[model samples]
Target: MENAFLNSLVVGAVLLGCAVFSALAGDPDALFDFIVPPGVMPANVSANNFTFRATKADFVAGKLIVQKISLAELPTLDGAGVSMATLMFPPSVADPVHFHQRASELLQVTSGSLFVSFIDSLGRRFDQKLFAGDAFLFPKGMLHYQINLDPKKPAHAVAVFGSSNPGIVLLGPTLFGSGLNVEVLHQSFNISKETIEKLVAANTPHPL
Candidate 1:
């Protein structure tokens, strides 16, 4: 009778081991002992800045709508460290010549026409005209800009950055608006005060 009991115990242990292995090997989603809780909602740890478009005539006829989205307020994943925003430029408008000092970026065009050009410190040059489904990568600290070449339509694109909060150091706003006075800017860019005022005034109201 004792041997019989020992045999029964051995069989029960074997069954338990098989069950454990089966559970582990099966679909990962079904591995939870009880129905797992749903995913958590994204948290807003910081307040996002708001800026209005510089021009109201963007929708009228011959103006541009440039939307700036800052990546700093976006949520971060555990292993991946990045955030992004879509920038839209209306027809015939141009993004200011700029550079991302710290973060590299991948810009993928989704609609309309886009013209991008590259310029090096030594005056070397290269450029490409992208349509609805083209993508390009701009390395960190390299200067670049996107222009809407379409004569009658708008252009849209998404920019993916390598950092969670890819800060934008806007060239015009940073250099011309606050840092240097009108006299300095006039000397640097070889433009008149009227032109400077018009350009500065065209800038969308941004966070201070």
Candidate 2:
């Protein structure tokens, strides 16, 4: 009888030790031999380039500052022979005629009115007026501009440059300067020589 009582006591102590270990483990299946605990929670991942909505208070001086989440600054990108700038044009603002010689640009308007114009190598011009949720793609080496149409409210658009570091080559700057003779354009584009001369003359002294 003592032996049986001691056997029962040993069994009860073993079960109690298992229960205590399970309580300390903080999982229901801690005592189970085949059950494994899950791993830790994952870290939150964000974008290299992203934009979140800003309230009215966020807009200062008619411009809403969108965080550039780019990996590096514009000049660093330029030194690698590429650069991109986050351009924010307030209402009724007009951007200069620009082109990316090395890469294309993709634009998406998150809010307000945006007007885009582009002139192709063949001298064909395309203009588009977009609203709050519109997007456009501009081909590389083409002249393009973005303007805000609304006079009272601001417009916000995001431009993703194709190159790791892309630079802008203004169209007039190339045509007017660098000793690119006007006659070449007249002969290539099938425009009148007089017209070409007049155009070059008008665009002389291009702005930086």
Candidate 3:
């Protein structure tokens, strides 16, 4: 069982690395083009053509900051493509429910603790508490969230994604602030119009 899990992790990492590389190269459509037929020399590619820098940004909630690496900031990954980010969450803060449409994610906790949860395709939910040195995987397109379990200390984790442009859709913002027809939402959610309005109001510029 342990060996299988480790093998899966390795496979996931390789897939993510390839996806990130392709997306960064602005050739997402070429994701599977590397599988050349026999007797063909693979295209010669190298990571020496460009440079890369890690960039940092603060989340809107002010409780978290993420430092990221991608092709945009590091063009040198043209051949060997991958993307990564380091997330720092302050005490008692939560990373809201969201999903990456294009990439699976691997997270490694370096400090403190985190409570992670996700819902699978069958609507079954899985939850785990991760401490320092622990790792978690969020499969592509799965809805997942995390919370800092420590009230006095901060939590830190490193995240690796399969795609350079792994798109993120936050549940609350997408549902409440997307500017879709309120009546449509009311009908779809089976909720009153007034409740939809209230939810839209609460999510404005403050999803947490």
Clashes of 3: 4
lDDT of 3 at 156: 91
Each model's lDDT = 0.65, 0.64, 0.77
Candidate 1: segments with Cα more than 4 A from true spot:
1-71, 77-79, 190-208
- Evaluation by lDDT, superior candidate among 2 and 3: 3
CA lDDT for candidate 1:
0.65
lDDT of prediction 2: 0.64
TM-score of each: 0.57, 0.49, 0.69
Please, what are the lDDT tens digits per residue for candidate 2 over residues 1-208?
Answer: 9999999999999999999965543213223222121231223222321233333435456553544423244212322222344556677776668886656778888888888999998899999998877888888778899888788888777777656434567666567554567678877789898887776776756443
Per-candidate RMSD, Å: 16.5, 22.4, 10.3
Each prediction's number of clashing residue pairs: 0, 4, 4
lDDT of 3 by residue, 30-136 (tens): 45523333333456433333334455555444477777675455544333335778899988888899997767889999999999988999999999999999999
Cα error, candidate 1, residue 94 (Å): 2.4
Which ranking of candidates, highest TM-score first?
A: 3, 1, 2
Model 3 residue 68 CA deviation in Å: 2.0
Query: Comparing 1 and 2 by lDDT, which wins?
Result: 1
Question: Superposing every Cα of model 3 onto the true structure, what RMSD results?
Answer: 10.3
